[model samples]
Target: MAISKLRCLGLVVMVTAQMVSAETLSPAQAPVAALDAAEPTVAAIAPQVDAEQWVRQTTSNLSSVRYINQLAALYLANGYAPLWQDSLATTALEEQLQLLALSGVSADFSRRYAQLAHLKQSNDWRQYDLLATDTLLAYMSYLEGLPEYGRGWLFGAGIDPSLPLPSSQGLNHLNSAIETGQLHAFIAALKPQDRRYTQLQRAIDALAQHSQASWPGFYQPGYIRLGTRLQQPEALITRLEQLGDLTPYQAAQLRTSNVRIYNIDLANAMKRFQERHGLKVDGVIGPQTRYWLMMPVQERIRILALNAQRLRLWPADFPSMLVVNIPAYDMSLWLDNKHVLDSKVIVGRPSRPTPLMSSTVASVVFNPYWNVPNSIMRKDILPKARYDRGYLYRNGFRVIRSWDSSEQIPIHTIDWRLVNAKAFPYRLRQQPGEKNALGRFKFNIPNNNAIYLHDTPAKSLFNKTTRAFSSGCIRVEHADDLARILLTDSGVSPQRVDELKARTNTRTVGLSNQVKVHLIYQTAWVDEDGQVNFRNDVYSYDQINPMSQKEEKFTFLFSGENPY
Candidate 1:
């Protein structure tokens, strides 16, 4: 029975090889010609006496042992036939591999895949086969697993770990189809169907095509103010055209003028460029705008690809929710998947980053009391109290013995300078009023981090372009509008919402319908107008090691486990 099965597998492999050869020379031959040149190595590795043993041994020798079982099952299902031996299947796989390399999720994988492409042209068939399998396993594992850095925080607390992933069954189906010569269909099926993902993919391809030449640097030592003549403005014009900020016609017109002035046309283009880079949309060529324009295309591509991976982490079907994008310093509310409200928001500073999490807003509080955190109490308030005896009264703050106690202790009763941070037993609570830190309303979300969305008395700070001034919690610019939406959704009448806000005393209103809230830190995404938006990596999280290290980690995970 074993010999007969081996013979059958051999026949299938030969026939599949012939089909791949015929398909390569057909109307779609142009793209496959590159793969056709590497066909000798694939053909040389075609013949195998013990296919299952070869698979097991090759997979066992590698660091991707975690996928050994899945790889074994895949080969077994195919009757131990080699999947990539056929030219058509190899070409299809190469195309998908190229897509992943370009997708900025991992720069290391991209570089490694480029090396493997070179190896495919060599005469070493055995090495080719082993590396091919390893590459496939790596790609499959990445698609299946959570993003390397975010898994801990994403699945840590408040987030639902049960949220469904892009289907593993879809991958299984693609594997089955690849064995049967449905290579193109299977490859196409594996591409993410998400709209934003596809848009970013197009953006990456466009940028790559335009990246053949080195982008010009803004070399002026000082700020290029509006209507000022600058040296060599053609470089700036070419860059704006390349970035899709200016049309080719506009670029040509600007170039033909033979002038180096920062004119209205250039200013308009600069404004468009500013909008895409999450800068203040002013026409002036300031240091920030010049800095973004000087960034290389490869770096931008990496940003785009990393964000595409982030989109993969999102649930296949997103529900109506409030989303806070930390790097963008923006908050958006979605109802039935349609954007309802967008507002400027204040996020945590780099030292105290607002954590990425998901939770449901269970209730809203009007005229909310600010229960100051211990860290802030010790770091901020205690020093101020020590310097000024009347500081507590000026800020509407009172000292309490414990969180449960309502009685306010007189500030003059205790000596602030004598109180050490570690030995301090008192809690500080700010009274409900305009002078209170938590201005008027607070959206209560269930999270262990003690983070909530609230109004701020320091409303002037929201007007700043860089709004990362908070301790940790989010401060909404349009807090009243957000509160109205949340309250109205919870079946509270508009009149009742008004009455609740007008109350001088603090009161909590339970929501009839809890709203989901997701705090994400994506630095790149395609906006609704099909424009690719990039933000400064506020926390300097853009740099991450390649996926190769992840594979090494995987090997360490099951170091002594049996490969069977």
Candidate 2:
């Protein structure tokens, strides 16, 4: 079974590599004419070296052990010739390195290779080769490390036990591209081609250009309410202009007008600023808005770069899928790569954060029963039941002896006071009704975490900006709409969906075709409009190392066993 799975994965990697290469320009088809014109003598320049010994030593010194074999294979593929030498290839490689350094996006690379700015003047061939090798290795390592860090935050320890590491064949393809003078194209292709990645990259570049100047801080003594005149609004206006919220014309107008007054123009500009930072767009300079405004340009650049690394983990395309962004408290459904539905969602609170995992929505259950998890039952229900004997009866909860047992015990028969968390053997299930926690419908996805998407009776929670109210399950505000769409796709008529909703009894409908669902925790991303959006890290996962460093340990509310 393991061998078969390995073979399947190898096939996928090979197909993906071929597709990437097909999309990218090869040596013959590439604008090598321009490259040749730029450096006429590059083709004549070659380095003298023992390729076998060079590969051996380079692989040994590199920390990325996974790519060492591929690097050796790359050297052998070129007939034991050095890929980077005193040629146009080396010049192009150096230009890319400088570009990366200047972008201020990759702190990990820039900090370690601050000397890259001076690499052009280096006369030593050995030093140049080592630097070039390190740069290539670092680039590959960066690509491989993103998925590793992403998996740690997404699956943690309980969901998926392991994530697929970078394969040797994939690395070899990248190495081959580098050896064949397609290093520029290879690195460019490695980056996510998504518009979000491009927008963030542009944003980073813009930030880097302005990093040298100190941005003016707007420190109002008190809260700047809407339509209020400030004692000094020059600093605020200047800051807005620097952040691109105010155009040159608007800035000039503000300077000419009553500068101390917080007019409608300034308020509108503040609202735009607020929207970019993921704050409530009330046009009021609240504490949160002020806090983000005070953040330095360099810090924002780092944040954008971090998010770019996260974007690299996502696939290039999803034909049809559902994406639940936990931090944004929102869900979007896409059909044929176009967003078909956008709805507010309630995710798990910080205490019981919604686990990030990829799975398929297999079935939808209407008028669903809430089989309360052990953690909720023990911590919440038991304590309340102990204090109030009528708690279970009022809440429409029934205690079953065990999961497989048909015997339902009377609530009065159990001694709630004596029942500790570990000793509790009975299963608690809430009957479907107006008060049912799983409100009207549930979308089940097979996972050990027992997490799912469902309707909720607490509809008012969706009105709040930060809706993190559940114990790992997602509460869809537009659950009925989502269910209708799913059912329609499964050959059910709209009238039938309405009829199903009218029914009082629970009904489970298996989907003929499952839809892929990705529960990602991206705190920062670029919207379709090319506007950068930021959100507060609701689960503190943002603090985890973006590199290959091990994440900090955490305990889940529920054990590994499926509680539902």
Candidate 3:
């Protein structure tokens, strides 16, 4: 389903810089209840009250409350006493809240927090017991929401983005933490567990260190080829140095040398920069690389932050899945959180970009017939057939008058030139063979979109670093091996897949369970080595800056998919 989640991500940040007005009016659905009258929570109360009865009455709407059960359990297990009343605990929570003033993730939580703050300040201390109980539990939601701020998650997949809520079994564990007086430690452990997330955090730190540095202006139309000489290359050297792409020794040599020629060393430095920025790692300072180089340091920092917030929304650990990253032109198969299959992929070109979605790998097709899309029939095949009459038959294609009937239509019976995409009534089918567009395998994922992952006959394209060559489907370099691995995983013996591949006819093998796949468009990610990687926004999703207030013209485009 389409959502404005990533779009909403830009509005706030992982850590919001929005100034908190402690004077805000009480807002949001209240938490379990308030903490001590001094701390923010759902309500204000005093001592000499029925803590258990008050908690039950105030937090009766446990399902509706963010973390009502967790809060209530903490109070209930502790004989209906306040949990976060410790000075150190309160101080720690305040710092976390202040750091996360970032309402970009969940504006709902922010409003709830403000309302709790309001209740804490109010002189009406009638519900002191309720306040003491909810203050800590409700604040727990805030801590859980920090790394995932601005990520409109459902809390299950896509992070289910629906977090903070606990199941019935978790209440026992919550009570144990309270019984052991480890609630503060328990709360402290409520951050993202992914190392990639922490890497993105480090990336932000690295960029922020130079946030105040004087950034060099973009050298427009800048193409400083190798061996090109310049009198003053100080700015160029400094910019590379500031980003840690260029080593100090190399940069210093370039800065102090009389002949500041773009040499191999400088080109190597540029390549490093290009690699990190998702550009071609050629030593040449080309237009694309120059454009990224020209971007203000602050803008890059924001971009990193935006990605970090997005990463936090992903499941902390998804044991099995296929993630096809569009921008990076790559696909990775993770099994038990380890890379089982890493293959280069060709995604849809800019004009027919692949839709960002999550689906499942339902089946495998060996020697699959290519059902040329109507769009391809109109735009690609028809025009060529009009001129080269032998194009269809010579290429092992058949013309079917109807999908159900499958009666072959004589190619020479009609005036090919007279037919256009709008008027074409026949379906084009390419016979499975050595020259078939889909080579040896097709990984099908059921979606409204016709997009799927499969093998391609055009093997040369996979060698390139930037491989956005497909019309819509993803073209994998190692489809045969991928199919075999998936088949084995699905309990379909390798011998069976091999047997199907040996035949001239098409075959389909359904998996025991559909492999979950998320075709995402992320431009920034942390690698296994803790290095942050960036890629070009091929889809232009980032054209509308995350921080910008403008919301127009950011419509979801999935024309490639058919409406179900």
Off by over 4 Å in 3: 1-190, 218-222, 256-259, 491-497, 545-564
Backbone atom clashes (below 3 Å) for every candidate = 2, 0, 24
lDDT, candidate 3, 26-105, per-residue tens: 11122222122332222122223344454555555332244444544554455433455454554555434432333123
Q: By TM-score, is 2 or 3 better?
A: 2
For lDDT, the strongest prediction is: 1
Q: What is the Å distance of residue 212 in model 2 from its true position?
A: 1.3
- lDDT of candidate model 1 versus the reference: 0.69
How far is 183's C-alpha from truth in model 1 (Å)? 6.7
Q: How many residue pairs clash in model 3?
A: 24
Give a tens-digit lDDT track for model 2, residues 31-64: 2121212222221111134444545553454332
Per-residue error for 378 in candidate 1, Å, reads: 0.6
Candidate 2 residue spans exceeding 4 A from truth: 1-82, 85-112, 121-126, 145-149, 153-167, 227-231, 545-564
Measured over all alpha carbons after superposition, the RMSD of each candidate to the real structure, in angstroms, is 8.8, 10.5, 11.1
225, model 1: CA deviation in Å?
A: 0.9
